[model samples]
Every structure is written in C-alpha cells, then in structure tokens.
Target: MDGYTTALVCAAAAAGAALVRSGKRYIDNSAVELLAAPDGVRAMIEAHCPSLVAPARARLVPPPYLPTGMLQTIYGAMVALRRDSESDIEYDRQLRTMEDGGTVSLDWFPARPSGPECAQPIAIVMSGLGGSAYEYHIRCLAKHLATKSRAGMRVAVLNYRGSGRTPLTSSTMYNGYDTSDIYDTVGYLAQSFPRAPLVCVGFSMGANLLARYLGETGDKSRIAACVTVSCPFSGETAGRAINAPGLLFDKFFQPALTGTIKRIVKRNQDIIQSGAITYDIDAIMRAKRVCDVDNALTARAYGFKDCWEYYAACSSTDFIERIRCPFLAINALDDPIALPEGLPMDQIAKNPRAAIALVAHGGHIGFFSGLSARMWHLQPVLEFLDAVLADKAE
Candidate 1:
C-alpha cells in the first residue's frame, strides 16, 4: 500500500481502539430496587444516585486488559499501586485507648473550617480487611469529602486494633463479628464534635462491621447516615466464594489474605502470647486459605466454637433487619470476594431504612471506569451521603 493508504489504515485502527476503550457499559435491569424504603427515601436516592437506575450507563468499564469481573476484582486488591490523579492524603493520627485497655488509631483529614463550634458533618471511614487510611480508595473518599463535598465534611478513618499498624495494647484483636471498636470510635467522634452530624462509610469487611453495629445499636446509633461498600453480608457464602478454587481466589486472594493474617499475628505476637487468643498461632501461620485463618484466629478470638459459628455470627442478614438509621449498601453483582449471591437483599427489604445499590459490573470494591479506569465508586457514595445530609437538614 502507498504511504497515504497505510496512514489511513493505522488511523482507523487507532480510532477503533479509542472507541472500545471509551465505550459505555450499560447496566442491565439497572433500576435500584428500594426494597421497603419510603417514597421520600426512594426519591432522594433516585435524585442523588441516579447511576443506580437500570438502562443507565454504568460508570465502571473494565480496562481492556482486565475485562472480566474476576480480573477487575483482583485489580481492586492492588489499587494501592495505581497512583492516579488523586493525591495521597495526609492525616493527623490520634491514638485512643479503648475501654478494654486495647488501643485504636484514628486518622483525621482536615476539613474546611465549619466554625468555632465545629458544625461540619463528619465522615468516618472504615477500611477493608488489613487496609488502612493509606489505602488508595480511602484517600480518594477523604479527598473528595474534604475538598469537594458541599458539606465540607471532616473525614476520619478508624484503624481497628492490630490493623493499620495500630498497636495491640491488649491481647484482644478485631474480627468481623466485633463492633466494639467502631462503636467506641463513633462515641468518641460524637463527643469530640458534638455539633457535627456524623456519617459513616465502610468498605468490605469494615462494611460488615458497620452494618452489624448499626443493627445492634438500632435507633440508638449516633450516625445520621451510613453507606457500606462491597460488604460480605452472608459470611458463609462469602467465605466459601473467597476460598473456592479459582485463578483470582487461589493464586491471589487466598495467599494475599493468608499472608495478611500471618502478618497481623506476627505483628501482635507479644500480645497474642499473653492469652485470650486460644488458636494455634503456628498452624494459623501455615494456613493456606482465609477460612483457615478465620477458623484458627477470628473465630477463637471472638469466643466462637469454630469458624462455622463465627461465620454464622458475622452474617449481616441477621443484623440488617434491626438497623434503624438511613443505610445504603453498594454491591457489585460481579464481586468475586464478596459474592453477589451473598447480598442481604431479603434482609434489606425487611427494613424501610435500608436500601441496596446493585450494579451489574463493578467487581468487589472495584468500580473503576472512565478512559483511564480510575476508581468510580466515590462519586455515588458522595452523592448518597450528600443527599442523606440534605434530607436530614430539611
């Protein structure tokens, strides 16, 4: 072919690639079912989180390289490596001594000044398993709320005991079943900023904890609104899915998560040796899957007979019915870790205050989209939060 013909062919190929990369992924059956939510709540969510509706274009399109749900879910696990335009958020760390002599760390992001009375709304972020305030998604949410949110929201991340490098002052460690640390942290924030309306956003395992806390506390929960992203609501199903034989689970998630368990145990070895943790630490270290770690550590740590009992206890379906606060659960149908089959849709349906945002394609906590496929969940979360606050103010 002549030089001109060759150039035209190349340009055509480039255009095709661009179209493929930037193509919109429409959500099927995208109307967000509000369950038993009131008309007002439904209207509020529809107005704010329009992306939840069906036939609407899903903001998250898997990168060309990572097209499948499993691949995207795996990508989410390594989000810390993708340093996008959102800058690393710096936080002022505060170490608080819990009632049990255990210590937890709170990382606070500076909010645009609300006033001398600290009247701004507060957003407390709870990171995923073995994650911290430094996690990429956490920073994105904090940055959005602190810099961009109309509420001028002050953001604080709760680094549970032994996670986020927080020192284990006592033999006690955090588990999916326990809500004490979060409960205490919420109380502390409430006291510190009495005038500030408190809101919460929890990711993955942290989401489960937040859900359980809301249910256990019922109407007494101080949180004005809450959002849970990629929560493994049904612990049994979620555990099985994560431990199942698969490219992502076996090669990546299992080992990575098992390693996190070992590291947590090793980091707090001095405290584990003191008592309370009755499991075989050496065996737990050799464990190949997350369930094994849960069986040996999490179940035993929380006084359960075994992992099965622990899983049953950790199930959020039992808790969702009791949650009286305005709550939203964002779940991806394609989530590999937090299996979509495990979503507490029935449980959520029972509570008028609760709703679930079911999207067709977001994998686990991965809702990455746009030309670059950067994190996309932040926008919907912000919208829901802003709506809740606005509704409350009225």
Candidate 2:
C-alpha cells in the first residue's frame, strides 16, 4: 500500500485505543468517541486552525492511522529515535548568572558532529510541571526544529526555576501559572541576539503561559511568531478532565508534585520555618483539586493567598483575547491532558492574528505513526512552521 493508504488504517485502529470506559473508576470520565471509518479510505476536506486541535475542540479532518503493520513500525522508529534523544542532553550550571540566589542551568541540545551558527531564530521551548528541559518529548521536538539540515535554527530547552538540573535559588518557584520568568528570559535573549527572530513554543501548561504573555503584552513582546502545542486553554474544562476518573492523571500527577513540594521544602528547613507558605504542598493537593500542578505549586511557592487566585491571574485563558502576537496553537481531541471542550474558541476567534489547528489524535504528544517508527514530520507542523519561517523580515 502507498503511504497515504497506510496512514488511514493506523488512524482507524488507533481510534479504538483512544476511548476510555465511561463508568470505570480509573479514567471513568474520558470524553472520547471512537469514530469508525468505512473501510478506511483516504479523503480530505478542510481542517480547523492549529490551536483548536490541542484543547477540547480539536478535530482532525481525517483520522490518523497507517495502511499496514509494516508502515506503522517504520513510522514509529523514526520518531522514537528523536524522542529518545533526551538521553543525550547535557546539563550545565552558570555560576555568575544566578537568579534570585539560585543556581541557573540549561539542558543543552547536542549539535551534529559539525557545528551550526546560532544566528537564526532559536526556538526557546518551555516545559510543563515537574518537567525538565531534558524531557524526552520536548527534546524530540527540539531535535526536529534544530536539525543540521535546518541548521539556521537552534533550540534552548528552558526548565523555568526549579524543574531542571539547577537548584531553585529563590523561595519563589517557576509555575505554568505565571509568565514573569518567561518575560525575563525572553528579554535576555532579545538583548543578547537582537538580530535573530525568536520564536517561542510551549507545550501543555507551558503553552498557557505563552498565550497569557502575548495577550497581556500584546505586540510589546519581542517574539516574531509563536506556537502553542497541546495547551489547555480553558481552566474550568481542563479542571474537570484533570478530575476525570479513568485517565488516572490526577492520581499520577498530584502525588509527584506533592512529593516535589516536600523535597523542595525538606531541602530548605529555614524556609519552612519562616511560614513563607500558606499550607504544606502535600496538604494543598490533598485538600483541593488543582487545575494543574502549577495551580497548586505557584500559590505555595509565591505566597499567594489561594491556588484559585494564582491560576486565574497566571493562566493565559483569562488574557487570550488580549494577545496581539502572531501565534499558532495546536490541539488534539484525543489528548488525554487537554480535553476537547477545554479550547477557548470564542476567545481565539476574537483574536484576528491567531490560528488554531485541531487534529483527530496524537496521544498527548505521541503523534508517532509511520513506517516502523519512522515519521513524516507529523504533517501540518513541519509544513506550517516552514511556511512561517519562510517569510523572513526582508
């Protein structure tokens, strides 16, 4: 079968994998509907904007699949190679560049045997939650964007404050719920690399911060173009999904954050004694259902009165309408993290400069489907970003 035919089959087979049992205790709350195709024929119509495909309202014009098992394996391997490249990231600390008295660090991307100039617009990507700049997934994306063939581009994997190899210096913590640090980091880059156009990409919670930053600052931001991949645009709807039963997401995520909070405090006895926080991190997660780990962590780390206040002020959905930057948002309906209903269609539509792309399935950044783990640039992303970069400011 041709490549096109192979993809259709994978999409159909994968559709069944996306459905979650409605009454099951685990992910009992999954809002998935497996769309059965008729013999899986190849066809295409119009597609929604990239941003719409990420959150709740994301939809793919054609379901994602492969024609045969042979194709699937081939596609899977190519992406897995890059995805696993996270193991190669090197962590380094900057002694003189300390922030808030904490050691600053970055997860360096491994350049090809030959070096490339960092002159082109570097992709500064932000990770979510207890996530590190060395996260396998984000590294996979960086590898794609910073290829030698595409050598003009470079990638900087940002760990915010506490999440990476560097120690958290200030009593304050980095949260997806806020964007001040992103602002500071971008400002530093703008000053350092004024000639290069900086493109910002954020995933999941990270995307929310990107959106919020653009909305709040409007055109004041120095970024030339932006991309938000699989961001939860609506707090209320995402909260419901986080609390969804079958996914076991809340169970898996909450405890990890809870433990990180403990570790963060345990490492600094003086901070705990200072009553710098309202409640213990574990206690907060136990008592209240947090929208995201950021919702809880930000409030505690920053001495906010409550998690609700922090989430509202920090999350981008509140300020999405205010964003005036040229931004692209990619969302998926099958995303376990960002539910379909969580997309802010009205707010996005209101922004004339924004575009949203909604795909049928890509398993929470697992858009792997091709010949034996080999991939085809994941479609629109490879093409769209290329087009975006093509129009350089002459």
TM per prediction: 0.88, 0.69
Per residue, candidate 1 scores C-alpha lDDT tens digits across 57-142 of: 43455556666667777777777645566847678888899998999998889733334478889899998877888888888888
Superposition-based RMSD of candidate 2 using all C-alpha atoms, in angstroms:
10.5
Q: How many clashing residue pairs appear in each of the predictions shown?
A: 4, 56
TM-score top scorer: 1
Model 2 per-residue lDDT at 264: 61
Query: Which segments of candidate 2 are over 4 A away from where they belong?
Result: 1-99, 102-104, 110-118, 148-151, 244-247, 269-297, 300-305, 371-379
Q: After the best TM-score superposition of candidate 2, give how far the Cα of residue 82 lies from its true spot, in angstroms.
A: 9.0
Which segments of model 1 are wrong by more than 4 Å? 1-40, 53-59, 111-116
lDDT of 2: 0.55
Worst 10 residues of 1 by lDDT: 24-33
lDDT of 1: 0.79
lDDT of 2 by residue, 1-394 (tens): 9999899988876775554332132222222222212221001101322322233422232213543222332233234334344234443323224444544444445431122333576677776655666555666666666663142566677776556655666666556565667777778677766766777788777888888888878868787667777787775455556555542444554455455655665575454335455535455345424444444555667666665666455556767767765566766566666777777776666666666655454544444332343222233444444445555543
